[model samples]
Target chain A: MNHLLNIVRKELKELMTIGSFVSVLIMMFVFMGAGSMMGDQGESITSPSDIGFINGDGGLWADRTEEFLISIYVDTYGISEEEARGFVKVMDIPLDDGAAIVEGMRSLGLDAAIAVGPGYSSNLDNGIRAVISEYYIFTNPGLLGSAGSSITSLMIGEISDRISQALVSEIADPDLTPFLLSPIKGTDAHTYIDGELHSGVRPLDISMGVMNQTLMVPVVIMMVIMMIGSIVISSMGNEKENKTLETLLTMPVGRTVIVTGKILSAAIMGLVYGIMYMVGMMFYSKGMTDIGGLGGSSPADLGLALGPVDWLIVGTMVFLAIFCALGLCMILGAFAKNYKAAQTMTVPISVLAIIPMLLNMFASWGSLPTAIQIPLFIIPFTHPMMVMQNLMFGNTAVVLAGMAYLALFAMLTIFITVKVYKSDILLTGIGQTKLAKAFAGKRIR
Target chain B: MDALTVEDVHKVYGDREAVKGIDFSVRTGEIFGLIGPNGAGKTSTLRMMSTLLRITSGRITVCGHDVATESDEVRKIISYLPEDAGAYKDLTGRAYLKFMAGFFADGAEAEKMVAYGMEMADLGDRIDSKVDTYSKGMMRRLLIARAIMPAPKVAIMDEVTSGLDVINAFEIRKIIRKISEQGVTVIISSHNMFEVDMLCDRVAMINDGRTVLCGTPGELKERFNASNLEEVFVKAVKG
Candidate 1:
């Protein structure tokens, strides 16, 4: 056990000491840092649609809400106080009815407006439903309007909850009211897929998953490819190049143990690089959303829920896929004569792994034409993402297919690596079959 | 009685026979040498004795244990250092020795062995630096130290001082002679006939995968009527 552990430790140490690992680490952190820096500017939202309020009820509750809105303009818009001063205006019109106030807001060219009714305070006192009328035109539909609506809804929800709490305390006990939240029922809001939408599957949360695909996934997948490929290949190639493989083979340790130890070392390195890249991407992604990229939605609208089973399925598939990649690299790396050759050998495989992941960012499986979708379905690399995306939305068929393909691919690659390592050609670099070598005393190295 | 034996041992790769039925034996603590030009099967023979390659036929044994059937036992008692062997560039010389020692010994024994090996290397403070920072001669010193670190019954060293300068080669040969005097049976294959003629208690000349001549350097030199082992090697190839 110590021997195996020592081997793993040595390989890992050597890899980390190599200059490339540090380079990749710096690269991830730098890009992420740049993204996070830009995220600051995006976080400070400047509302494109100004809010207009008509205070008609003159009731304590309605007027209190108005006061709260006025006081929190900077907080709601996420802007500097000086910049938020010009954000909203209280339109003073002679008309007190909700409809008249809304019409007046339109005439005044306000993008969004709210009118409180006379029955609002009375209805609350009577424990009846209180309704506030709203009118709005969303001019900047993409980012500004989305963010404005998100913040507006959140604020409205908070005010309603407070009112409901007051009513519940009246019906029950005032002492317990502040400590208790009011109970209410509401339907969940999800994104709408143009067609083939699942009934209950929440729309893919925009900032976390969708933004992650575009902003984080490509960089992460590339990092995974380079990090794992370079580590695995260079390890074998170094042993072969320096003539240590033969020495190590002669040791009492079994070949499988050596291979497993090397694999474990490389896997650990890949995970480290993956984690670093992920952290960097998280900062970068936040920055992107902050800068009006895949962001703009309030935190509540961005809430994502993935069940335990879905997480399990995605985790298993990703592990299998990465394992398959590692195995493929090991096999190809055996044929290489040097570190450069080893890295070059993995290029095609890296390309295969990367292209699909990048493409998945721009288009969904259903949206792409049948010809394109079929190719995506066939790729082993495509399965992990599909499994992750579909499992949440209850696509059992896609998940099972992806699972089977990944398992088979992983097994096949492992078998190939084992066969190559067991062969004498692994030492000699002979691209020859035993049958072709009628005069085969030649060494590969 | 022989501490090491090779009885008509042969290694065939496909249809190519690299070592064709070579037979020899070394008594306990004797320094045996294999002298041959390129492709003369000298390294192949050392590799076979060291249990690095499978023998196609016949038998090989060290201290009466078969190299084929009891390879693990043979490996424990033997250390093989191939020509131009490279150390892990990232590891310090001291750490490298300790790592090798860990394979055969545990705990205090491993540390003690590593300490002894470091002493043998004679690298001093530079042993703490990574091998990549070491000079070519330093690398050779480290390899030689690692080979004998296990205190093996048999040390198979192939062309140990192959590419060293005069000073480094002399230093390495001096170490080999010192280790031999301490009762470690040594099998060395080298192209340096003078070094072999001086260090080896016995020598064998191989050509075309077969041993054409065998005996001590003086005996072979007298038989060939040559003034030096290099002349003996030249005459053996021609004759």
Candidate 2:
């Protein structure tokens, strides 16, 4: 019993390292930051009131439709009718002028615009279905970007019910009134994404389509980065543990070659893993799209598919991201005393990868505040995760900028890794400082 | 010609000075031994010569190449076998030898080195097995073969026969003597005074990061009126 206790105590001592504690703390902070970002996004999505109203009908029912929408907005938000009017902008424009509608929405900061047709009231009174066209402005492809349009659709449904209730009370024909209760039907929605209008496609449909394809990209990228990072760091740790690094370092090879060789090999392995994961994810995404009925209108039909050149660009970004991860792992691995400590070294990379992945999943890059976006853009792994969305939206400049930044980041990290390889820290294991020495002693103990 | 030179070498790690102004030189084909007790800075001195650690102050040169500024050139002509060295466990013994040999030579020349290493290790069929399966004696033999197979002008070995049985130690000493006979200068550090007295042509006895005595084994014993190098070390360090 005493021997068993002693063995358990020794195992605990070996497992508890400063590196492990620090890694756990970093992971905690990353999760906390993600939660805060998610909370902000929730607030942004739920309280949307940026709606534009265009009454082309100029009839009693059209006016009534506008009035009912404002009334419902006021009730839902618990605001006065005047304040609700201030939130909903009214425009007098021709229904055929799609360009004017887009310009009006952008200039008015409207999330969506509802345009009533010229014969809406007359058609409804004559027992014919009335048409209301919805124009959605998509500033980003994020899941939250379509929140305003979705809420406006619900408001339109409420207005149709309210108009039906008013008609039923006025008319004595109960059978006709029952059929006319939901007389107002929406026409095919038009979405303006990044200044180009896509006719007949709702923002929600496009958002769902984009989500179906790309939701797994960030996850796969995160996994691949962590996988390759662990491999590189563990390689260093194993070399140190086996005492083979001293022999390799003293060999007639240049430090740069050693650094590059390790990074390149790990990157190749990461690419292989990434390809395997992406193939599996592709089939899974296809199956999901088919089951969810999103396959009827592929993203290609909506002009959201990547061309050959775009895929090449994405390939470059992924390669650069892998290089950056490998370089970073090499630097962290230099401080590792052995394989156990190297496992902890992968935490920072995981945190970096996860931050971008979560942000890409929940929020669009354009929807995020500058403070959040800047850091997200700076993380090397963020580029590959975001490149597909940017290219689909024809934001070529942003994609190019990301690739440039990743290249520069990869170069800088490789330089630093080489410096570490040449330094005594590789062999001495970061014992240059008194605090580090204390930690090293604790780790050994 | 001198195969290696250490001029007033000092190594500082944080606040501690592991090797303080220790100086020595080894001639061509000489079996030079750094004889010291544990923590006497023998391994530190060997590491500095191997270019694995930087000299905090002073200089070391191998075959007219400075270890600090011309480390690549110095590395080309010297081989370092750390006291607790190991090969990649996942690789077979022959593969490990081939990988190390590729750094010095290529293709046919590399194959030649592998054959010679296999001959030196004398493990026969076991050389095809993974390095992780080898016993301690076999591992040591394989490492010794790797270090000597490169035909380095100067070989720096730290505690070459440490943790080995008498038979393994005897076999390694004979191998070291044979390498020295082939005109490769050898600098070996050891805590075993008996081993140093028998294997080394000349010895530097270091204590507490400084050399206490430096002479041929016979001269050191005669000067101290001792029967063996262990007594010589005791008398020198105590006095």
Candidate 3:
């Protein structure tokens, strides 16, 4: 134990002396800044709020539909017609004058505005007269036609007919009205499909949040494992390359002890990186609030929201991630002929560890079928983010399952890697073991 | 009793026999030098003797401990310094020494041992500095100091002075002699013929996985009618 500790101490010292220990942290910080600014944040539409409302009106549904149309814009979509008119920014604005709006629609190749005309509700009530209109002054006839349905069609029939009746009572010959509305029938009929303010599934927000923490664990774990594996394998390889390993082997210290000592040293270095990364991330989370669109919660809120179950999930994933990384790195390290080769080999393993993280971070929930989820859940990396998601939305079973899976994988991976490391001490260059080669390929590219 | 012994040790690398059943022993309190040309199986023999490599056949014992079965015992009894020594660059020299000291925690009086090691290396205040800052000579000194500081029953050095300047080499030789005087057995492998001639009590010449000659330098010299150990080696190899 003392001998192993000595090796670890030595490895840690070497890691500190070289600056590679701090490099990943810097990379993560830069990745965070750049990633946040990449999509929808950097170069986007100038106006923060430009809700486009396409008007499609049938001639018979005109007056009542116009009044209903104006009311639905205010009440259903939760945006007042008054606010919509005033909200248009004229600076480089495309929709100011009627001609420009028309030209803009033409350039976009839209045949007509998307409109819910009057009397559309009455037709639906009759079960025969569908609200139909002749779309013109446009090139692309398909534009806005597919997306537009009478507000009456959107709501339940009972509510739709009542709203149509109310709109009809307000005007005579509603057929000539320009703007039309299909009455919002139900109490909860407000469904904003394309509106920006609605909080549906913001993948970017979840991804940024999940990735911030998710990518962090694996990156740190892989780096730590690589750190240790590098030290052990490189130290041995250095000995062999310089013909010194042969000498050490001849010493009274025997192959096992010497190998153990070297491995211990590597493990120790990896642990240091792990600790450094964890602590660094802990510090990093303090500043995470500076970047928005990453789940509108503070790190503190995230921490408070997570319970013991969440920790188990995180812990399991972290353990498994480290286990897999350490084992694979050790195997890679053993095959490397020199320090440079060992380091080169680490790049691929690092990337492989991160693949799971990327998959977990960016994949939309319910999008992956159960068949995919079963295997994906088996990968320890999926657990942390999965658990994070569960915790955020108050899901218990997923958190527990993710934790269990992580634990299983972590134990299995670490055990196997250790076995490979022990067997490959004297073996130089890439060996003939199919499993090792396959894993190496996964790590390298 | 022999301080170190290798009995009919053979090391086979796949099908190639690196060390083909070689045998030798070193006495207590003496400097034993194993000299050989490049790829002469010197390293293989030294490795088997040191317990770093397993013997394909036969046995090796250090201070009465078997190399294979009693490896931990062998480790405790001897310190082996390979020709290419590396220091942990991440640690301060003092911390590194302390860490090495901790290896023999129960037996090693760490504080005193580390201090003596630092003082012997002549590092002064630089002992507190990280080893990455050390020069080649400094690193060599530190490694030598680390190996000898534990005061093992046997010391195995592989090309210990290869990178040293004359001054540092002389200084290390002085330290080796000092260590030997204290009854520690010293076994070394080197290409420097003069060093072997000057320091070894007995010399073994190896070539192509076998020991061609083994005797006191003077005995070999007298037998070969040569002036020095180098000429003796030349004559032995040639014949």
Candidate 4:
């Protein structure tokens, strides 16, 4: 029992390194950042949405429709009457042009606009259906950007019900008004995406469906990259810690062959892991869709489905990304002196994989600012995560470009890894690096 | 012709030099020893000769192939066993031997090498057990077998019997003598002067990265006016 305790104590001391501690801390920060972003989006989902109301029909029913819109803010959001009145802005503008209505909504800082057409009140009073148009201005494209459109659609549905209830209560014959209770008819929603108007489609539904399909790609990519990267690094660490590296290095093999062999083995393992995760994700995504009622619009209907050739391109991109990750890990592993240090070495690769995953999840690549885009593009892992979405949207040029960049990046990493394998750094570690020397306040001779 | 030649070799790590202009030669089938205190650059010298490290200056050749320019050729003819060498813990002793033998030969010849390694290790039925389960002495025997199993032209071993009991150390010494008799040139480094005297045909005493003495055990003792190699090492290193 004492010998067992002694061995346990020794193992604990060996495993608990400062590098491991720092890596955990870094992971904590990444989770916190993601949580903060999600919290912001959550706020957007629950809060009262701002919308512009244009009354083209100068009648009592149009006035009542506008009032019902404000009532949504008061009852649902728990806001005071005065604040609710201000939440729905009544615009005295002509609703003849669709583009002008969208422009008016944007200028008023509203994501959606409701335009009541001419004869709306008269038609409804006569028991004929009154048509109302909902204009959704999509300034951003992602899961986060779709929140406003979702809220606006929910609010519009509630107002239509409230106006119908008012009409039914005032009817002389209650039995006659039963069929006409739902007099308000909403035309197909108009969505302005990237300044181009897409008629008869809701941006929210399109984004939600696209999110469900492409979401798993980035998540699976991140997991596979981190897992395989850790394996390659730990393999090098084990070789060094076991004192087997010296013997292996002295063997009759070229350094390139050694580096390539390690990468290929790790890449094969990564592909196996990726396939398993993808199969699991497929079931998981199906479960989520069923439980959350997230059926939304089908991507095929929105012209965003991937064909056979697109899938092949995505597969190639994924393969290249894995190759790049293995090569990068091989270079980092060269600096690891032991297994403990190798665990820490995985943190940088983790950060790289995670940054792209989070960004791709929250924002569309085309919608991101160039400042963020350039740096994200430079990370080799980002290409695979973005490829599925790009291919879905028929951005074949962008997908091909990403594939080319990934191929270039993979080759560059392999070249560097081979050099590191040939160098003494594999044995001597960071002690000989100029960065280490600089930190030690020593000049290189 | 010399089996190995290290001509004025130097090893530098950034601002510090580990081995400074050390020169030596070994004849075919000779069991040469590099004797030094801790951190005396003995391992660095041997590592450079085995093509595991780059020479900052000068040249080392194994069977007339330059270690720097012809490292691939040098690796083909040499094997290195570090002081604290370990086999893959997950592999059985026989599996580990087979893995190393695969690198040097294939098919029936590789099978023959594995058989020879099993004989050299002499672990009996224990050779089928995982390496991690082996005792320190047993592990040392297995590693020594792995180093010589390839039948390379030169074998470099650092501290071959380090951290072993009296019986284990003596057995390993006998194995070293047997290997040398098989016409394999061996280079070894150790702090145990008595073991060096018994196992080595020639010895070099190094201190502060320089070769301070080089001769047979008897010649070194006589030159330093000492009774044994230990006394000679102390006299030579101190002087």
Query: Lowest-lDDT window of 10 residues in candidate 4 chain B?
Result: B230-239
Please say which candidate is ahead in lDDT: 3 or 4: 4
Q: What does candidate 3's lDDT look like per residue over B80-143, in tens digits? A: 7877777667788898788777766534478888888888788888888998899888888888
| Superposed Cα deviation of residue B133, candidate 2 (Å) | 1.3
* Candidate 2 ranges beyond 4 A from true positions: A1-16, A172-174, A177-181, A194-196, A293-297, A438-445
Rank candidates by lDDT, best first: 2, 4, 1, 3
lDDT of 4 at A400: 79
- TM-score for candidate 3, please give it: 0.63
Please name the candidate that would achieve the greatest lDDT relative to the true structure: 2
Report the C-alpha lDDT of model 2 over B1-239, residue by residue, as the tens digit. Answer: 78888888888888888888788788999999999999999988888888888889888999989999999899999999999789999999999999999999999999999999999898989999999999999999999999999899999999999999999999999999999999999999999989999999999989889878888999999999999999998888788
Ranking by TM-score: 2, 4, 1, 3
Write the residue-wise lDDT of candidate 3 on A258-368 in tens digits: 545554555566667778888988677646746565333232323324668667666656655555555555556657777655565565455444544444444433334
Ranking by DockQ: 2, 4, 1, 3
lDDT of 2 by residue, A115-180 (tens): 898898898788777878889877664776565567777887888888878877777676686456
For all predicted structures, in order, the TM-scores are: 0.65, 0.95, 0.63, 0.85
In model 2 chain A, where is the ten-residue run with the lowest total lDDT?
A: A292-301
DockQ score, prediction 1: 0.27
lDDT for predicted candidate 4 compared with the true structure:
0.85
lDDT-best of 2 and 4 = 2
Q: What TM-score does the predicted chain A of each candidate obtain versus native chain A?
A: 0.50, 0.92, 0.45, 0.77
lDDT of every model, 2 decimals: 0.69, 0.87, 0.59, 0.85
